[model samples]
Target: MAVSMVGTNSLYTCLDMIDKMVSVNEGYIAKAILALLETEKCVVEGAGAVTLAAIMEGKLPELQGKR
Candidate 1:
């Protein structure tokens, strides 16, 4: 979860969409971070890696053949 004193309305919206679609949580986010660090040699925050996590966890199977 990101803490922004400015506001989190947009963040909440994206999180809600992730929850409803892929049910991503902290575990997935952590896995994404580690995978990125190992493979891409990059560091990313939890929220920044949610989509990668979903792809890594095979939540987007529909895209397999399309790609």
Candidate 2:
């Protein structure tokens, strides 16, 4: 499933949102998201990336398998 983090707001600006579905048994995905955002300051202020981070890491089980 794909998690649509790009809301009606203009957080994404003009950056392209990349959605990738991944297995979630382990915490690798979240960890990766945190690491990427932490190390990559260029991705800062990009609402699309932020939304992707939430989808890949923050969302709960109820949110998974659906969006």
Candidate 3:
């Protein structure tokens, strides 16, 4: 399970809206951060990079090509 400093309301909203959840390790998070920096010229913190990490790790194949 993942816990965050995010607000309860935001957590509640996410719980209500999301159909699935996936977990990625620190290595994936680090890779994601580097990927964003290297490819998109963007820098993101670990928590902010998790979704991309999941996608990169093939944990969310269903989300491929999604908007």
Best by lDDT: 3
lDDT per residue (tens digit) for residues 1-67 in model 1: 5444525786686775553456466788899999989988999988878887777777877655453
Q: 1-62 in candidate 2: lDDT tens per residue?
A: 24476465554554367344343423444555556678775443333344454556655444
Residues 1-67, model 3: lDDT tens digits:
3666767887797987888867798899999999999989997899888999998888999988887
User: Backbone collision count in every prediction?
Assistant: 0, 1, 0
- Positional deviation of 15 in candidate 3, in angstroms? 2.9
Identify the runs in model 1 with alpha carbons over 4 angstroms from their true place: 1-20, 65-67
Q: Where is model 3 poorest over a 10-residue stretch in terms of lDDT?
A: 1-10
Model 2 regions more than 4 Å off: 2-26, 42-67
For every candidate structure, what is the RMSD over all alpha carbons to the true structure, in angstroms?
A: 5.4, 10.9, 3.5
What C-alpha root-mean-square deviation, in Å, does candidate 2 show against the real structure? 10.9
How far is 39's C-alpha from truth in model 2 (Å)? Answer: 0.7
